[model samples]
Target: MEEIKMNTIYDNEKFFNKYSQMTRSQKGLAGAGEWHTLQKLLPDFTDKTVLDLGCGYGWHCLYAAEHGAKAVTGVDLSEKMLAVAKEKTAGYPVNYLQADIATLTFPVATFDVVLSSLAIHYVADFKRLILNIKQYLKTDGILVFSVEHPAFTAEGSQDFYYDEKGNILHYPLDNYFNEGIREANFLGEKVTKYHRTLTTYLNTLLKNDFTLLNVVEPTPATELLALPEMKEELRRPMMLIIKAKNNL
Candidate 1:
């Protein structure tokens, strides 16, 4: 199959907008991993300042503040999404800023930790985004994030799904290595998301002085294991838990 840009499916503003709202499920799923990674990565976050990128409704950021984080701020390009996050994290020090990750400007070494969850996939210019985070993080600070599995995005990766009689079926997506913007409406507002392959993401982080530490995958909680569909997903790499540090 040939590669296709992210424009095909993400072209619909309505559907895309719905995806940006709380209707999106991946945020919660990825957020669960964030919770796990947090305890493992920063066990002593009580006095640390944090910046959450693409923080849809600030679930993780709020969790940090409730438990420990000295202060937390979230940034996203979609105001509607940020609005929801703002409401969800109301009465807390969690601040929300609406801006594209590409041109986001912040003070130098301003945060103790920078986190994102399945949010970086929407960035087309991954290199510049990572570099931009440098100014936001103090030395020895960690950038923790999660990403969709590349195997699912690879060409012909749908073989794992078979019909009742063993006939394989799939989403029929081409351009598995897509790198482009998906235009859509998020929360009734026009917005676009950029897509880049996993390799490009890794290379960009490495180029930006990020040192990889831990890469993890989520394990279903006891509740999810009872569900057949989720149980099957455990056999493959569905998501990634990446812990990286910017030496500078």
Candidate 2:
């Protein structure tokens, strides 16, 4: 993936601040499943120093603070995102910093947990990112994150079509296990995302002095299943949750 820019509306602090506020108005971000997912990860957070990478608007950071975390620090490439994060986290036990994830400069061994949710895919230099995250996590510290499923985003494996029964089938428009770099959309435009097989991710985690503990594939919610158009693919993975612990 190349160094592509974020949408200007999302790049500027003023615009991003409003953008985030607007998102909160829409419906839900940490809707039920996410709330429960966080509950499942609670052991990783209690009384811990947490670093939230790509912490868009500080949603998880704020949640961490509310959950008895000693402190939560969030970092993001967009000053705007960070700015809004700062505002959103005000009066809470969380701090927001503006920085690019690919070149983060957190002090070595500084965090008990380095977590990210739905954000790491934006990094172009993912290998370097894997290495850098090690610098901040304490030994036995965990790296827990969620991202778009590689299988769903892979080239030939990604498609939205129908079968003989007229039932919708959303399968590979490309290979499910290819080293492909593609882009996802943000407000009708494109942003780069790397598509790697699960083995690729596992290998990278292993090479970085970390061990995989779990991989959770969240099924679509009841609301999604209730939608006639989404029922066919309800059993499919909508996102992937990965958990690992640093051994170094």
Candidate 3:
């Protein structure tokens, strides 16, 4: 088993430069494939304190602040990513922190809402992270997060199986029951991601006293479907979004 340390993969100059060029990095929430669906699942942010784990470029943090969140704290391990987040965030009640999502701590009942966008899959211990989230959230606080779907990670390739003629035949899936660290190639580099079954994702929250609200296997935003490549998303679920409440 490869030990999962503080993940600073996003800080690598080559990887950071390439990631900075992604549509999501440039256009914020509008460029995210699942934002259309995920946004609908979020509770109103009015006057709420928000904590965004693995907050990347802090799009969600800014959105919360812009929409009346009392305060927003965005945490990520990459100094470069945080630098960009801070540079773009001005006159908004948003704070950027350079910290590891797997070990960062917050006081109890510290926030009214907690969010993570496509980032939790990198943490090695999902249960511990959420347990801390449960403790940090106020009573009835909302938690919304999205991650790369297990089915997409099951095969370790995070890609499609193509035919001899070069058309994508299907997304390959195997070793699905075996969940753990996966070495996946992303942006032409080996990236480390953790895989957990859908059941584990839901059951962990249930056992930890979270009331399940909704589970989404999101498709590309409707407008994105017009793009030739986006249409392929219909064939497989690449992301999972979950909304839950602290049932205290």
Candidate 4:
């Protein structure tokens, strides 16, 4: 399949403005739940060279530096996002770069750990991206990432059928086998995402010689349960986290 160039909705001026106003943890990653679970799967960063693909706002990059990573590089497609990340990571060891994760290149075996958070789904050819990722990691280096769950993305709409009484009847699962670009509403604007099956996600890593370490479909934490909106997450997974080792 031909790769789609990433022009993420995050690059939209209004969306970036709104997104920039939110706290890092609130937007996603850190605090608890799936984000916290993904963090637990990471290897120690002490003195390790780390690279973050699609590193929005450089939260993970900053975290790696704070945890004693010798060097940290953050790559993102959005100039606005990279600017924010650069400003936020000032005085830290993190280096922010503006580049498309799908097409970015790096020296072979340059990093001990590669991380991406809530990204990668925007790329049309994830298998190819995984292959590129393998070339950038050292032997036994780790690749950790999170993306929208196949089950959730399969529908594109990410909506549940509800009765007139406003109760959810059931979650739809049509066109699950049809993989490609999916358009949906996000923060009152239309956004695009790519859908891939669970098999594709796992098999691609295996085909690229990556050893699968762990997979997680996060459940809401105890504190999150108090929020009504978070209740829907209990019914179905919204995200999938995977950790793999470059065994080359």
Candidate 5:
């Protein structure tokens, strides 16, 4: 219920080091497990202005620029992440800003498309954030974002219950209706995340004059199932992607 300060945990040396090594961090959008589905939900970027929230490493920013976006802005709170984003973004010419997405503002109708990848759950005030986003977006502009699924966040621990043999027994789901701060351990460090139900996520958008276009819960593709880790994804949905249009 209460908003917390913007989380800059990604700037921590150990966490940043670990995050920098992730497949998505190094190889960009192609390396993300949900990219296949998320990409499908994205509106064509051709000559449109784009704003990417929590744009760690600027993967989506570069993708938009390369795909014909006229202007692209990437915002994040972590300096370490922005450093890497700036370095890797050589010729793409993305405007990367080290600012908290929750507090950052843009002029009305500033962007044609707003994108956030795997970062919304960390926000403490979901409703307020989206309202701000709606104001920044042009009429009928698109908003596409991915977050840790509510089912995955419902358990608080954000991990699976395992059997004695170390096989995942189930991804436990409890306190699903209790939406608030969730202190999760990631990369050997504690990080803050917020939990919100699917109902809240959808209804909030609908109430804010945004029309839902698509809601995708991505899973590994058939070919990816051959990998040992990909099979575990079938047991529970880990990510949620939503695409909506701002209707003035």
Candidate 6:
């Protein structure tokens, strides 16, 4: 197996420092508004074994445990994040493993569900990760994950720019075809991320024999829409959520 390089951005104190302060609900899976959307796509966790890839802070692991999961295993590369996860998930039927999710190994058919939230984008070999996930999940097991939207990542830049009047401006769409590593500022820290087109994400699952279940680009709730700052998300999707099943 080829060794996969781990992205150390999350391990940086600057990023996790800000992340550590946020509550689980405030983080909301990928973002603040997508939690309910993700929840709707989830299968019943009652007594199921679940694995959360790149499980930062153990939020989803704890969530699975809370929802009657028999065992929840969380894998993350960041020791700092794992420490926080351990502290937060103490006493839960959850295990936190500090390992590069891309290179982590598990027994075949070990999990009923594999979950990831905005984590795989940091992985360079997403195809390998998907294939490994297929091996880890039981037949009919589900994989649910969210990532930075291809449209958003395509631009390389963040979002729309406005004039002094705050009127809508053009949203940049550049290099949509170029899919690879991208560097950007996150919470004032320069970070590395891997960008893959929507087709790449879909075709990867299909090529691995995963049956598509659902795809969602969530919209903010009414309360969020009430904020002027949140209106831009309505203009363009920031995240992509996908649910697929292991049919083989």
lDDT of 3 at 212: 94
Task: Give the alpha carbon lDDT tens digit for every residue of 163-185 in model 3.
Answer: 99999898888999999989887
lDDT of 4 at 137: 92
lDDT of 4 by residue, 149-245 (tens): 9999998888889999999988888798999989755555667889999999999999889999999898766776776767778888888999999
Measured over all alpha carbons after superposition, the RMSD of each candidate to the real structure, in angstroms, is 5.6, 4.2, 2.3, 3.4, 2.9, 4.1
Is candidate 1 or 4 superior in lDDT? 4
**What is the C-alpha local distance difference test score of candidate 4?**
0.84
**TM-score to native of every candidate shown:** 0.73, 0.81, 0.95, 0.92, 0.94, 0.90
Residue-by-residue lDDT tens digits, candidate 2, 192-231 = 6667777777789998879888888765456545645346
| Model 3: lowest-lDDT 10 consecutive positions | 1-10
Q: Kindly report which residue stretches of model 2 are placed more than 4 angstroms away from their true locations once superposed.
A: 1-4, 7-9, 12-25, 32-35, 156-159, 162-169, 223-235
Can you write out model 6's per-residue Cα lDDT over 26-96, one digit (the tens) per residue?
A: 55454466676788898899999999998887888988999999999999988888887888789989998
User: Model 6: which ten-residue window has the lowest total lDDT?
Assistant: 1-10
- Assess each prediction's global lDDT (C-alpha) against the native: 0.67, 0.70, 0.89, 0.84, 0.86, 0.83
Best by lDDT: 3
Using TM-score as the measure, the top candidate is: 3
Per-residue CA lDDT of model 1 for 11-91, tens digit only, reads 345544556554124556442523444456643568889888878667778877887888998987665567677888888
- CA shift at 19, candidate 6, in angstroms? 3.0
Model 1: colliding residue pairs = 3-175, 4-175, 13-185, 17-185, 17-186, 57-85
- Flag regions of model 5 displaced more than 4 Å: 1-6
Arrange candidates, best lDDT first.
Answer: 3, 5, 4, 6, 2, 1
Give a tens-digit lDDT track for model 5, residues 1-248.
22223465777676678888876677677767788888888899998999999998888998899899989999998998888888777777588888878878989999999999988898889999999998999999999999999998987887788889998788888999999988776666666889999999999999999999999999876766776667788889999999999998
Give me the overall lDDT of model 6: 0.83
Candidate 2 global TM-score: 0.81
